[model samples]
Target: MRRRRGLTEEERELWSRVAASAQAMHPARPEMPAALTPPPREPVVAPKSLAKAFRVGEKARPRTGHDLAPPIGEGLAALPVVMDRKAHRNMVRGKLEPEAKLDLHGMTLAQAHPELIHFVLTAQDRGHRLILVITGKGKPGRDDDPVPQRMGVLRHQVPHWLRLPPLGAVVMQVTEAHLKHGGAGAYYIYLRRLR
Candidate 1:
Protein backbone atom coordinates (compact mmCIF):
# COMPACT_ATOMS: atom_id res chain seq x y z
CA MET A 1 0.00 0.00 0.00
CA ARG A 2 2.79 2.39 0.87
CA ARG A 3 6.24 2.46 -0.73
CA ARG A 4 9.38 2.85 1.37
CA ARG A 5 11.51 5.79 0.32
CA GLY A 6 14.94 5.23 -1.19
CA LEU A 7 18.13 5.82 0.78
CA THR A 8 19.20 9.44 1.17
CA GLU A 9 22.46 10.73 -0.31
CA GLU A 10 24.21 10.59 3.10
CA GLU A 11 22.97 7.04 3.65
CA ARG A 12 24.18 6.02 0.20
CA GLU A 13 27.60 7.51 0.86
CA LEU A 14 27.83 5.69 4.18
CA TRP A 15 26.85 2.41 2.54
CA SER A 16 29.43 2.82 -0.23
CA ARG A 17 32.21 3.44 2.33
CA VAL A 18 31.12 0.49 4.47
CA ALA A 19 30.98 -1.77 1.44
CA ALA A 20 34.43 -0.66 0.20
CA SER A 21 36.16 -1.57 3.49
CA ALA A 22 34.16 -4.74 4.22
CA GLN A 23 35.71 -8.19 3.63
CA ALA A 24 33.91 -11.53 3.46
CA MET A 25 33.65 -13.14 6.92
CA HIS A 26 34.22 -16.58 5.37
CA PRO A 27 35.64 -17.05 1.89
CA ALA A 28 34.46 -20.15 0.02
CA ARG A 29 36.80 -22.10 -2.24
CA PRO A 30 35.68 -25.46 -3.59
CA GLU A 31 38.21 -28.24 -3.31
CA MET A 32 39.08 -29.52 -6.79
CA PRO A 33 41.91 -31.50 -8.47
CA ALA A 34 44.52 -29.23 -10.11
CA ALA A 35 43.55 -30.62 -13.51
CA LEU A 36 39.89 -29.78 -12.95
CA THR A 37 40.57 -26.26 -11.63
CA PRO A 38 40.02 -23.54 -14.21
CA PRO A 39 42.75 -20.93 -14.61
CA PRO A 40 41.98 -17.55 -13.07
CA ARG A 41 41.38 -14.65 -15.45
CA GLU A 42 41.49 -10.87 -15.02
CA PRO A 43 38.20 -9.42 -13.68
CA VAL A 44 36.24 -7.78 -16.45
CA VAL A 45 34.85 -4.33 -15.68
CA ALA A 46 32.34 -2.34 -17.68
CA PRO A 47 33.70 0.86 -19.22
CA LYS A 48 32.58 3.93 -17.25
CA SER A 49 30.80 5.09 -20.39
CA LEU A 50 28.83 1.85 -20.53
CA ALA A 51 28.04 1.63 -16.81
CA LYS A 52 24.38 2.17 -15.92
CA ALA A 53 23.29 4.55 -13.18
CA PHE A 54 20.81 3.42 -10.55
CA ARG A 55 19.30 4.77 -7.33
CA VAL A 56 19.08 2.96 -4.02
CA GLY A 57 15.87 0.91 -3.38
CA GLU A 58 14.78 1.06 -6.98
CA LYS A 59 12.27 -1.47 -8.28
CA ALA A 60 13.61 -4.74 -9.66
CA ARG A 61 15.09 -4.72 -13.18
CA PRO A 62 12.51 -4.83 -15.93
CA ARG A 63 11.36 -8.31 -16.79
CA THR A 64 13.19 -9.79 -19.83
CA GLY A 65 10.10 -11.14 -21.61
CA HIS A 66 7.74 -8.98 -23.71
CA ASP A 67 4.76 -11.27 -23.13
CA LEU A 68 3.96 -9.91 -19.67
CA ALA A 69 1.16 -7.34 -19.24
CA PRO A 70 1.00 -4.50 -16.73
CA PRO A 71 -0.87 -4.88 -13.45
CA ILE A 72 -4.70 -4.78 -13.76
CA GLY A 73 -5.05 -1.47 -11.91
CA GLU A 74 -2.35 0.16 -14.04
CA GLY A 75 -3.71 -1.17 -17.32
CA LEU A 76 -7.26 -0.12 -16.44
CA ALA A 77 -6.17 3.33 -15.28
CA ALA A 78 -4.41 3.98 -18.56
CA LEU A 79 -7.60 3.58 -20.58
CA PRO A 80 -9.25 6.87 -21.57
CA VAL A 81 -12.36 7.71 -19.60
CA VAL A 82 -15.34 6.53 -21.70
CA MET A 83 -18.09 7.65 -19.33
CA ASP A 84 -19.19 10.88 -17.61
CA ARG A 85 -16.42 12.57 -15.63
CA LYS A 86 -18.38 13.10 -12.40
CA ALA A 87 -19.82 9.57 -12.52
CA HIS A 88 -16.40 8.15 -13.27
CA ARG A 89 -14.87 9.80 -10.24
CA ASN A 90 -17.80 8.76 -8.06
CA MET A 91 -17.65 5.18 -9.34
CA VAL A 92 -13.92 4.90 -8.70
CA ARG A 93 -14.27 6.54 -5.28
CA GLY A 94 -17.02 4.11 -4.25
CA LYS A 95 -19.62 6.86 -4.17
CA LEU A 96 -21.79 5.10 -6.75
CA GLU A 97 -23.09 1.55 -6.26
CA PRO A 98 -24.04 -1.10 -8.80
CA GLU A 99 -27.66 -2.04 -9.38
CA ALA A 100 -26.98 -5.75 -9.86
CA LYS A 101 -24.15 -8.14 -9.12
CA LEU A 102 -22.92 -11.49 -10.50
CA ASP A 103 -20.53 -13.83 -8.72
CA LEU A 104 -18.36 -16.24 -10.71
CA HIS A 105 -16.13 -17.31 -7.84
CA GLY A 106 -16.06 -21.12 -8.18
CA MET A 107 -16.59 -21.53 -11.93
CA THR A 108 -13.82 -22.67 -14.25
CA LEU A 109 -12.96 -20.70 -17.41
CA ALA A 110 -15.27 -22.70 -19.67
CA GLN A 111 -18.23 -22.27 -17.32
CA ALA A 112 -17.59 -18.62 -16.32
CA HIS A 113 -17.46 -17.40 -19.96
CA PRO A 114 -21.07 -18.09 -20.98
CA GLU A 115 -22.36 -17.13 -17.57
CA LEU A 116 -20.69 -13.74 -17.89
CA ILE A 117 -22.12 -13.17 -21.37
CA HIS A 118 -25.64 -13.89 -20.20
CA PHE A 119 -25.31 -11.69 -17.11
CA VAL A 120 -24.00 -8.68 -19.00
CA LEU A 121 -26.57 -8.92 -21.79
CA THR A 122 -29.39 -9.38 -19.36
CA ALA A 123 -28.30 -6.40 -17.26
CA GLN A 124 -28.16 -4.20 -20.37
CA ASP A 125 -31.59 -5.39 -21.51
CA ARG A 126 -33.05 -4.71 -18.09
CA GLY A 127 -31.87 -1.09 -18.43
CA HIS A 128 -29.46 -1.31 -15.57
CA ARG A 129 -26.81 1.41 -15.80
CA LEU A 130 -24.31 -0.14 -13.43
CA ILE A 131 -23.49 -3.67 -12.25
CA LEU A 132 -20.84 -5.50 -10.28
CA VAL A 133 -19.02 -8.63 -11.41
CA ILE A 134 -17.33 -10.57 -8.60
CA THR A 135 -14.60 -12.92 -9.68
CA GLY A 136 -12.99 -13.78 -6.36
CA LYS A 137 -9.22 -13.56 -6.26
CA GLY A 138 -8.10 -17.01 -7.43
CA LYS A 139 -7.27 -19.78 -4.97
CA PRO A 140 -3.90 -21.54 -4.91
CA GLY A 141 -3.58 -25.27 -5.64
CA ARG A 142 -3.14 -27.94 -2.99
CA ASP A 143 0.43 -29.08 -2.26
CA ASP A 144 -0.30 -32.68 -3.27
CA ASP A 145 -2.02 -31.79 -6.57
CA PRO A 146 -0.34 -33.68 -9.40
CA VAL A 147 -0.33 -30.78 -11.86
CA PRO A 148 0.66 -27.20 -11.14
CA GLN A 149 -2.31 -24.84 -10.84
CA ARG A 150 -2.53 -21.12 -11.46
CA MET A 151 -4.41 -18.93 -8.93
CA GLY A 152 -6.81 -16.01 -9.57
CA VAL A 153 -7.76 -17.49 -12.96
CA LEU A 154 -11.02 -15.53 -13.12
CA ARG A 155 -9.74 -12.23 -11.69
CA HIS A 156 -7.45 -11.71 -14.69
CA GLN A 157 -9.65 -13.18 -17.43
CA VAL A 158 -12.91 -11.40 -16.63
CA PRO A 159 -11.73 -7.99 -17.81
CA HIS A 160 -10.48 -9.36 -21.14
CA TRP A 161 -13.74 -11.25 -21.57
CA LEU A 162 -15.77 -8.09 -20.95
CA ARG A 163 -14.00 -6.37 -23.83
CA LEU A 164 -15.04 -8.98 -26.40
CA PRO A 165 -18.21 -8.85 -28.49
CA PRO A 166 -21.65 -9.93 -27.11
CA LEU A 167 -20.59 -8.05 -23.96
CA GLY A 168 -18.23 -5.33 -25.12
CA ALA A 169 -20.92 -4.01 -27.43
CA VAL A 170 -23.05 -3.16 -24.37
CA VAL A 171 -20.38 -2.25 -21.82
CA MET A 172 -19.11 1.29 -21.38
CA GLN A 173 -16.71 1.47 -18.45
CA VAL A 174 -15.19 -1.23 -16.23
CA THR A 175 -13.25 -0.34 -13.10
CA GLU A 176 -12.01 -2.11 -9.98
CA ALA A 177 -14.49 -2.24 -7.12
CA HIS A 178 -14.01 -0.24 -3.92
CA LEU A 179 -13.44 -1.67 -0.45
CA LYS A 180 -17.20 -1.67 0.22
CA HIS A 181 -17.55 -4.06 -2.70
CA GLY A 182 -15.00 -6.81 -3.38
CA GLY A 183 -11.94 -4.61 -3.86
CA ALA A 184 -9.53 -6.30 -6.30
CA GLY A 185 -11.69 -9.40 -6.52
CA ALA A 186 -14.67 -7.42 -7.90
CA TYR A 187 -15.25 -4.93 -10.75
CA TYR A 188 -17.75 -2.10 -11.24
CA ILE A 189 -19.21 -2.28 -14.74
CA TYR A 190 -20.96 0.83 -16.11
CA LEU A 191 -23.13 -0.18 -19.07
CA ARG A 192 -23.63 2.04 -22.07
CA ARG A 193 -27.11 3.47 -22.57
CA LEU A 194 -29.40 0.90 -24.18
CA ARG A 195 -30.61 1.75 -27.69
Candidate 2:
Protein backbone atom coordinates (compact mmCIF):
# COMPACT_ATOMS: atom_id res chain seq x y z
CA MET A 1 0.00 0.00 0.00
CA ARG A 2 1.15 3.55 -0.79
CA ARG A 3 1.80 5.97 2.14
CA ARG A 4 -1.34 8.07 2.74
CA ARG A 5 -1.14 11.90 2.53
CA GLY A 6 -2.96 14.13 5.12
CA LEU A 7 -5.56 16.78 4.08
CA THR A 8 -4.21 20.24 3.20
CA GLU A 9 -4.75 23.21 5.57
CA GLU A 10 -7.44 24.61 3.14
CA GLU A 11 -9.24 21.22 3.01
CA ARG A 12 -9.25 20.98 6.88
CA GLU A 13 -10.65 24.54 7.12
CA LEU A 14 -13.40 23.77 4.53
CA TRP A 15 -14.52 20.57 6.41
CA SER A 16 -14.66 22.46 9.75
CA ARG A 17 -16.82 25.22 8.20
CA VAL A 18 -19.22 22.63 6.67
CA ALA A 19 -19.56 20.80 10.03
CA ALA A 20 -20.23 24.08 11.88
CA SER A 21 -22.87 25.17 9.31
CA ALA A 22 -24.63 21.75 9.55
CA GLN A 23 -24.63 21.88 13.39
CA ALA A 24 -26.13 25.44 13.25
CA MET A 25 -28.91 24.26 10.83
CA HIS A 26 -30.09 21.25 12.95
CA PRO A 27 -30.57 20.70 16.72
CA ALA A 28 -29.86 17.33 18.44
CA ARG A 29 -33.64 16.68 18.67
CA PRO A 30 -36.02 18.49 16.34
CA GLU A 31 -39.05 20.37 17.79
CA MET A 32 -42.06 18.71 16.03
CA PRO A 33 -44.97 20.83 14.84
CA ALA A 34 -48.18 20.75 16.99
CA ALA A 35 -50.06 19.30 13.96
CA LEU A 36 -47.52 16.45 13.74
CA THR A 37 -47.50 15.73 17.50
CA PRO A 38 -49.38 12.48 18.36
CA PRO A 39 -52.81 12.93 19.94
CA PRO A 40 -53.62 11.36 23.36
CA ARG A 41 -56.77 9.63 21.96
CA GLU A 42 -56.78 7.11 19.06
CA PRO A 43 -57.66 8.59 15.68
CA VAL A 44 -60.77 7.35 13.93
CA VAL A 45 -61.99 7.87 10.34
CA ALA A 46 -65.80 8.12 9.90
CA PRO A 47 -67.19 5.28 7.78
CA LYS A 48 -69.06 7.59 5.39
CA SER A 49 -66.03 9.82 4.92
CA LEU A 50 -63.78 6.81 4.39
CA ALA A 51 -66.26 5.23 1.95
CA LYS A 52 -66.52 8.43 -0.06
CA ALA A 53 -62.73 8.73 -0.16
CA PHE A 54 -62.43 5.17 -1.55
CA ARG A 55 -65.59 5.40 -3.76
CA VAL A 56 -65.41 3.11 -6.82
CA GLY A 57 -64.87 4.61 -10.27
CA GLU A 58 -67.59 4.72 -12.94
CA LYS A 59 -65.78 1.95 -14.84
CA ALA A 60 -65.52 -0.35 -11.80
CA ARG A 61 -65.43 -4.10 -12.58
CA PRO A 62 -68.62 -6.14 -12.13
CA ARG A 63 -69.06 -8.12 -8.90
CA THR A 64 -67.45 -11.59 -9.03
CA GLY A 65 -68.52 -14.87 -7.32
CA HIS A 66 -66.28 -13.98 -4.33
CA ASP A 67 -68.24 -10.75 -3.65
CA LEU A 68 -70.42 -10.77 -0.49
CA ALA A 69 -74.20 -10.91 -1.01
CA PRO A 70 -77.25 -11.72 1.12
CA PRO A 71 -78.40 -15.35 0.98
CA ILE A 72 -81.56 -16.14 -1.04
CA GLY A 73 -83.36 -17.43 2.06
CA GLU A 74 -82.21 -18.23 5.63
CA GLY A 75 -78.89 -19.45 4.11
CA LEU A 76 -77.46 -22.99 3.93
CA ALA A 77 -77.71 -25.50 6.83
CA ALA A 78 -73.95 -25.55 6.93
CA LEU A 79 -71.41 -23.74 4.73
CA PRO A 80 -70.54 -26.21 1.97
CA VAL A 81 -66.95 -27.45 2.03
CA VAL A 82 -64.69 -26.34 -0.88
CA MET A 83 -65.30 -27.98 -4.31
CA ASP A 84 -65.07 -27.04 -7.99
CA ARG A 85 -68.07 -25.55 -9.82
CA LYS A 86 -68.87 -28.66 -11.95
CA ALA A 87 -68.96 -31.00 -8.92
CA HIS A 88 -71.07 -28.53 -6.95
CA ARG A 89 -73.44 -28.11 -9.92
CA ASN A 90 -73.86 -31.88 -10.34
CA MET A 91 -74.57 -32.33 -6.62
CA VAL A 92 -77.00 -29.36 -6.61
CA ARG A 93 -78.81 -30.80 -9.65
CA GLY A 94 -79.19 -34.20 -7.85
CA LYS A 95 -77.30 -35.96 -10.65
CA LEU A 96 -74.92 -37.68 -8.22
CA GLU A 97 -76.86 -40.20 -6.10
CA PRO A 98 -75.72 -41.12 -2.61
CA GLU A 99 -74.36 -44.66 -2.25
CA ALA A 100 -75.05 -44.87 1.50
CA LYS A 101 -76.87 -42.74 4.08
CA LEU A 102 -77.09 -42.34 7.86
CA ASP A 103 -79.93 -40.53 9.66
CA LEU A 104 -79.14 -39.02 13.06
CA HIS A 105 -82.51 -37.28 13.32
CA GLY A 106 -83.75 -38.66 16.67
CA MET A 107 -80.30 -39.49 18.07
CA THR A 108 -78.22 -37.40 20.49
CA LEU A 109 -74.61 -36.27 19.70
CA ALA A 110 -73.15 -39.27 21.58
CA GLN A 111 -75.29 -41.75 19.58
CA ALA A 112 -74.62 -39.92 16.31
CA HIS A 113 -70.81 -39.68 16.79
CA PRO A 114 -69.91 -43.38 16.50
CA GLU A 115 -72.51 -44.01 13.80
CA LEU A 116 -71.22 -41.12 11.65
CA ILE A 117 -67.58 -42.27 11.95
CA HIS A 118 -68.47 -45.89 11.17
CA PHE A 119 -70.71 -44.90 8.22
CA VAL A 120 -68.07 -42.62 6.65
CA LEU A 121 -65.27 -45.19 7.05
CA THR A 122 -67.43 -47.99 5.62
CA ALA A 123 -68.55 -45.86 2.62
CA GLN A 124 -64.95 -44.72 1.94
CA ASP A 125 -63.75 -48.32 2.09
CA ARG A 126 -66.40 -49.25 -0.45
CA GLY A 127 -65.46 -46.29 -2.75
CA HIS A 128 -68.66 -44.29 -2.40
CA ARG A 129 -68.55 -40.80 -3.98
CA LEU A 130 -71.66 -39.21 -2.46
CA ILE A 131 -73.63 -40.09 0.69
CA LEU A 132 -76.44 -38.42 2.62
CA VAL A 133 -76.47 -37.80 6.39
CA ILE A 134 -79.77 -36.51 7.75
CA THR A 135 -79.61 -34.25 10.79
CA GLY A 136 -83.18 -33.08 11.30
CA LYS A 137 -83.96 -29.40 11.72
CA GLY A 138 -84.67 -29.08 15.44
CA LYS A 139 -88.22 -28.47 16.74
CA PRO A 140 -89.61 -24.95 16.97
CA GLY A 141 -89.47 -23.29 20.39
CA ARG A 142 -92.29 -21.28 22.04
CA ASP A 143 -91.98 -17.52 21.41
CA ASP A 144 -92.56 -16.70 25.11
CA ASP A 145 -89.84 -19.05 26.41
CA PRO A 146 -87.40 -17.17 28.72
CA VAL A 147 -84.37 -18.77 27.02
CA PRO A 148 -84.82 -19.99 23.44
CA GLN A 149 -84.40 -23.72 22.84
CA ARG A 150 -81.08 -24.52 21.14
CA MET A 151 -82.83 -26.38 18.35
CA GLY A 152 -81.00 -28.20 15.49
CA VAL A 153 -77.94 -29.19 17.54
CA LEU A 154 -77.06 -31.89 14.98
CA ARG A 155 -77.45 -29.55 12.00
CA HIS A 156 -74.70 -27.34 13.46
CA GLN A 157 -72.54 -30.03 15.13
CA VAL A 158 -72.34 -32.51 12.20
CA PRO A 159 -70.61 -30.01 9.90
CA HIS A 160 -68.00 -29.25 12.61
CA TRP A 161 -67.41 -32.97 13.22
CA LEU A 162 -66.92 -33.67 9.48
CA ARG A 163 -64.27 -30.90 9.46
CA LEU A 164 -62.24 -32.41 12.34
CA PRO A 165 -59.17 -34.65 11.80
CA PRO A 166 -59.68 -38.14 10.21
CA LEU A 167 -63.14 -37.09 8.97
CA GLY A 168 -61.83 -33.96 7.22
CA ALA A 169 -59.10 -36.11 5.66
CA VAL A 170 -61.69 -38.40 3.97
CA VAL A 171 -64.47 -35.87 3.25
CA MET A 172 -64.23 -33.82 0.04
CA GLN A 173 -67.39 -31.72 0.34
CA VAL A 174 -70.24 -31.41 2.89
CA THR A 175 -73.26 -29.57 1.48
CA GLU A 176 -76.95 -29.30 2.41
CA ALA A 177 -78.85 -32.20 0.83
CA HIS A 178 -81.42 -31.62 -1.91
CA LEU A 179 -85.18 -31.48 -1.12
CA LYS A 180 -85.61 -35.10 -2.39
CA HIS A 181 -82.93 -36.28 0.10
CA GLY A 182 -84.40 -34.55 3.22
CA GLY A 183 -83.69 -30.88 2.21
CA ALA A 184 -82.14 -28.69 4.92
CA GLY A 185 -82.50 -31.54 7.46
CA ALA A 186 -79.75 -33.53 5.68
CA TYR A 187 -76.23 -33.08 4.19
CA TYR A 188 -74.45 -34.60 1.18
CA ILE A 189 -71.02 -35.87 2.22
CA TYR A 190 -68.75 -36.33 -0.84
CA LEU A 191 -65.89 -38.61 0.15
CA ARG A 192 -62.36 -38.75 -1.32
CA ARG A 193 -61.32 -41.98 -3.09
CA LEU A 194 -58.90 -44.23 -1.21
CA ARG A 195 -55.26 -43.72 -2.21
Assess the local accuracy of residue 116 in candidate 1 as a C-alpha lDDT between 0 and 100. Answer: 94
**Residue by residue across 1-195, what tens digits does model 2's lDDT show?**
999999999999999999887745555797899999987997777766444445558778853223133321134434654777798888877777889989897898899988899999999999898899999887754545565445577887887798897798999887787888887788888888899
The lDDT, on a scale of 0 to 1, for candidate 1 is 0.87
TM-score winner among the candidates? 1
- Candidate 2 segments whose C-alpha is farther than 4 A from its true place: 1-81, 141-145
TM value for model 1: 0.61
Error of 1 at 48 (Å): 29
TM-score computed on alpha carbons, candidate 2: 0.56
> Residue pairs in steric clash, candidate 2?
none
Those runs of model 1 whose alpha carbons end farther than 4 Å from true positions after fitting are 1-68, 141-150
Error of 2 at 82 (Å): 3.4
